[model samples]
Target: MDNDEPLESKTTEETETQPAPQSSDEMLYCEAEVPTPVDKEKAGRENSETDLEIEDTEKLFTTGQKELYTEACKLMGVVPVSCFLRNMEESYMNLNHHGLGPHGTKAIAIALVSNTTVISLEVADNCIMEEGTLSLVEMLQENYYLQELNISDNALGLEGAKIISEFLQRNSSSLFNLQLSGNNFKDDSAELLCQALSANYRIKEIDLSHNQFSDKGGELLGHMLALNVGLLSLDLSWNHLCSQAAMALSNGLKANITLKTLDLSMNGFGNEGAAALAEVLRLNSCLASLDISSNDISTEGVSKISKGLEFNESLKVLKLFLNPISIDGATLLILSIKKNPKSKMENLDISNVMVSEQFVKTLDGVYAVHPQLDVVYKSIQGLSVKKTILQWTNPMKLIQSYADQKEITILDFFKSLSATGAMKMSAGEFWKAMTKQNQVPLNRSQLRELTKRLEDSTGMVDFSVLSVAKP
Candidate 1:
């Protein structure tokens, strides 16, 4: 009987007396004994209650919704989403990029009036013009179930803004989130919307990016932010807010207490604007996140912001990516955060900017004090000191030319290079892609510079912006 020797087989009688072998599934429920009569009765009652609850949930979609769905399907020449008809208990309906034009949008709007199950709805990039928006506004006025709505890129210009403004003015508490980006809303429409927002107090978040809002509109909206007490998040990126406008906005934010997140990226907010925002940061304690990437903020502006960061305790996330703030500016930020012993700062995004070794060492020391703080960047001190054959040139033109030569849309080109099938790619990935192709004829230094020039606060290059720039 050596340890490695095989055991003998059991006798037939002994095998018969042994317990039966159990499968994995049986082993899992080995302790689950047969229920007693009383236990069975309790389980039956619980199952009956669950059945009744399910039935009630199914009834949330009423006969009215069925009739509306039928009518809408016929008018739109397409079946309504299963969430409306079949899965009547669903709370979200996403119809983004469905090519639902004005007619289809109106038909859907008519059906949505009776939809009590849906709480969040998305109909973005559907080509729903002003006519469709009018129908939606009418539906929104009547329908009270929807709490979140997205109708971005619907070509709903000034008229649509006015319609939405009227809705907001009247709406007491139903809607909580809104997305109105790329709607061509100008200063006048912005003023009207701001006035409406000022009066209404239910909306918690809003996106007004890619619009035509200038200094005047920015001022009005800033005034609205000062008065509005319910808003928690506001995005005004890719607009025309300059020094004066930004200063006005910052001044207004001094009095606000509820707003937590603010994005003003891709604006003309230079050093002057940064100086004003510095004042805001020093005083405002409610703001948790602020993004001002690509606002032409230089070392001087960073100095101002650094001074603010020394005193700021509530701000958690700061994105200064794509600014001309060199290593010196990054160092200032690190020192500023370190100086603030009570700093609640969590994320500091200086992506696409090259940092010096000294700056990196200082950031490491700051990490000792604030273990939760994250500093995001792509390039190091070596890249900053490299000499280039040619002076810095705009790579956007080359990218556009490459798209043309490839005989594909700009979006398609970017999507082809993107690993996630999105319109954006990381700076490192983009540079690698550029190196593999002669379509974008540029040297290594140029490629590195291109990545830095295009990347946003998250170190992502959004190539789809080129498509929007096209006619």
Candidate 2:
């Protein structure tokens, strides 16, 4: 054959070797072909191996956790062995020591209650170190359920505190109460914590007692307090906070309206700090309780507080215990009480303070002078007389006559009338009428007869009988 004829023949052979283009239906049928039995078996075997591997890994993790827990329980000697397998909402095992080293404990803590809502773990008096605290903080950051955490007395120093502060800053945790008391957190740690608090609004209460927080830490905390509206209580007792810290706290208190209770006891808040706090108290309308006990507060400091008390009506409890407060301070406090007639104060503790007998006597006198004062005195016959004399300055002969009778104290008479049913009157109405009448005191015999008649008449006894002579 010629060369051109040979090439044409080769092209023809190539074309013949190429398969023809199939129709759309033929393509669809080819694509829909099912896998062979061997391929199906191979796929199923691979899937089964994957499932087994996953199950084995899970079993290994679980077994490791259980072993750790058992070891921890044995180390801590916690009785009634409580083991949680899954779904721990709020785990409160305060003071329970699991003998795991810091790392192991933290791992278990994170694993055991990884999905908890609130973790109140009190490792007080434990020897937890920085490494353990860091691990715990990492777990906290990863956790979504934990809200309130109490890790007090873990011996975690500034380094550990810093780690926790980092987590607090990043996590939008539901944690509201964070107690770091007895942790020896110094100024740096405190500042870190305050920074975290300022950034995070979830925490409501922070206890920093028994730490080394000095003026710097106090200043930071105070600044945070000024801006934070969520915090309700702040305890900085025994922190060596001096006048500088007190001044900062005072400034913060002026801006803060949500904080109701503040504890500054054992902080050495001398006259300066006390005066600063007093000023804050004068302006604050929400703070209900203040504890300045065990400080070096003297008469001057107390005078400042007393001055504040004159303008403050919200403070119901004031503690000035273990201070150098004397008669002068007491006198000032009594005067403040007198000036502020609308004070709703329930208790005032100045115990262990250098208060003079004269101060007590003055307090008694002031107590006697209050318009709503109720003085309870015991008689020689062991009978208690509660006399709530009104502030009526007018001299009425009828009241004098009743006072001379000395039959019963005003409270006793009212109580008897109430018990006898003669005073079908409600407590408010009876007090109103009694108050309106100026409480004409009656002699024991007359009071007794009145009560008896009141009982006999079921609170409907006629008062006209008192005008008649004795039978």
* Runs off by more than 4 Å, candidate 2: 1-91, 96-100, 114-119, 142-146, 353-471
lDDT of 2 by residue, 1-471 (tens): 011111111322222322332443322111112124312321122232231121234543564443444333222222112223221334664433433345334434545433444456554554557755665565555556656666777778878778788877874556677888888788888888888877776777788889888889889988988887787778888888889989998998899879888888998778999899889878999987788888898998888888888888777667877788666666687779778876655446765544444554665556544422321211222223333123222333344445458664433444444446352552223433443343564432233333344333333334344334242
Residue-level error in angstroms, candidate 2, position 178? 1.2
User: Against the hidden true structure, what lDDT does model 1 obtain?
Assistant: 0.74
Error of 1 at 417 (Å): 40
Q: What lDDT does model 2 reach?
A: 0.59
Model 2, residue pairs in steric clash = 147-175, 402-441, 405-443, 407-443, 407-444, 422-459
Please give, for residues 26-84, the per-residue lDDT of candidate 1 as tens digits.
Answer: 31211222224312321121232231111234333554565555444333333233333
Every candidate's lDDT: 0.74, 0.59
Q: After superposition, how far is residue 97 of candidate 1 from its true place, in Å?
A: 2.0
TM per prediction:
0.67, 0.60
Separate clash counts for every candidate: 0, 6
Ten-residue stretch with the least lDDT total in model 2: 1-10
Q: Rate residue 414 of model 1 by lDDT.
A: 62
